[model samples]
Target: MSDIDPGQARPPRRVRVDLPGRAYDILIGAGLVDAAGSILAERLPDARLAIVTDETVAALHLDRLTASLDAAGIAHAVVTVPPGETSKSFRQLEHVVDAILAGRFERGDAVLAFGGGVVGDLAGFAAAIVRRGMRFVQMPTTLLAQVDSSVGGKTGINSPRGKNLVGAFHQPDLVLADTSVLDTLVPREFAAGYAEVVKYGLIDRPEFFDWLEWKRAPIFAGGPERAEAIAASCEAKAAVVIADEREAGERALLNLGHTFGHAIEAAVAFDPARLVHGEAVSIGMAQAHRFSARLGLCPGQDATRVEAHLKAAGLPTRLSEVPGAAIAREVLMAGIAQDKKVKRGRLTFILTRGIGRSFIAADVDAAQIDEFLAEELAG
Candidate 1:
């Protein structure tokens, strides 16, 4: 049972991502969706909003948001796409851009991404390119989006060549992460998002990792720990984004498990049923630790501990755990090669020395990754 009451209103926690001239705040709490209209009305008083969401989120949350907007007398339009990873494509991007243009949204107007990472990415990209980049706001409805994607300015659509191959660094004007919305997620979806929460600890907060292990149940049960975890994760990400908004340097640390994870996602064709982003990241983080240990860079026990914690959280920590047909080593490697971190054919990965010690490893040998993939696939 949840320790927090569903109808209770908690004051929102704020994490600020302070970029040079485009700083934004991520407000996390219950009832944010219901309060969004007044919030937006206060911040962008004259600006009309184009709410871009997906079918799933729209069905579950559109009314609440629209009702709030209506209450505040804020003018808005909605553009909804099909749900899931498949919607983060060029076709959907075109559709969203066309809709915004058709609605005659001006540069001063805002594009509100009211879904998970896919919607945030797709809608943000549309906001970036349409009308030469309209103001963007993130109203992320999923755990994954709330803790990770919603804070960063990274926006894009997946290309046939690889995941997130086409995108832009368009910062959001504001981010509202309503923790209450997480209750509507299926267990698997919530677990997948929890994988990302674990990532912050893995990247550089060993104490946070230890805390997660102790508080896992409460988090899953929607206790105060759940909100605490989200706020901590956001703070971690905001620090990184503040230091390296463009991912030119330290921001890459945030992708600690993403290289291998993205490869697995690409191999599985980004199918949520097979493996969602957070689940792939769980596997990738485990693999990264294991690989680091294999290369004598990290302690083997740390890798085991990571896998153990992820498993306890109901996250898949191995590629073999991904459902459906076996993922080919070649396909996995192809996906890695197209990773955004790759530079001039040299593979760049976020590897760790141990818990809370992740770092960027540029110019990693491709052969080593191939060998690792072969071993993982064989298992």
Candidate 2:
């Protein structure tokens, strides 16, 4: 329940997201999952919980979590869905919600999302819609979830139109990011996860981006550097969310690469075989830099540097690099048009003037995007 672990290179760090009347803490470090039951028992005494995880995660880590709950005298039931983006759909959401209801869990009971982004989104959305907004907890077990998805509580299921087209703004009551769990990930997954960390730097914390450029190796090696990066990303997001909880203004900055990323996802039909969220975001971020260069808003060297870093990390930096993702100009345009960022038939893009100077370019010309996609597709 405390933020100390002498065995760790650095003591666990905590970031608070202060929402109006509903503040929550994001705990990032090596042992949060193992300590979750004690943490929860202290935070929400006698509250029942339904643990929602994906099959892959449940197989790998659920037993330890259940053991923790038992040690703390807490009651919990586990519900697991398939691992992947497909699980973040209405069908899976219904299954999760029904499982919770059938388990006789009440509104006061928390739905603990104990996996990566898919489980977090699906389970969080379930918790949001069930019992007219039940309490939810985030026990993120992956690098991607630990840094980005787990903190903000932007939970949702996907729609036929696009990725995250259907979702709700439901903040979590608590977030436990267990960095040790990330050690289980293969290099590709870890690299993909690192993309989100870069995103925070690319957002407004330009200094953080500069830090990552030098410290990426240690960050990936996992220790104090990993903890520091996660804590910083959470702090950065908490500031934006506290200022604009609903993405009505500055929070839109958080979607720096999402517009283009989601378009790529929509075109690929959200296939993990082709690309995952972070990989799409990697390509999208590089594309954003390149697109800005094309628009004469940024220097080409900046775009090249971004692409070089992503490529070195094994992330796709160009549209051509995304496996099995050859999106046509019209299809790309259509997907962008249907993106969540599009408001009233106008498009919003996060373009950069330099590596860390990203700004919202509202009502960007659709023809320009089309022309860019045409060139992007050609390459």
Best by TM-score: 2
Lowest summed-lDDT stretch of 10 residues in model 1?
1-10
TM-scores, each model vs. reference: 0.93, 0.93
Task: Give the poorly placed runs of model 2, Cα more than 4 Å off.
Answer: 1-6
Compared with the true structure, all predictions reach lDDT values of: 0.89, 0.85
TM-score of candidate 1 versus the correct structure, residues matched by position: 0.93
Error of 1 at 356 (Å): 0.2
TM-score result, candidate 2: 0.93
Candidate 2 residue-wise lDDT, 1-379, digit = tens: 3433557735458898888888988888887777888889998887899999988998888888888899899999989899887888889989999999999998888999999888999989999999889899998888888888866668998787556878898889989898888888988899989999899888777789888888888888876788889999888878887898777888888888888998887778777778888899998899899899998998999889888877877788888876763667787788888777888988899998988899998889998888888888877
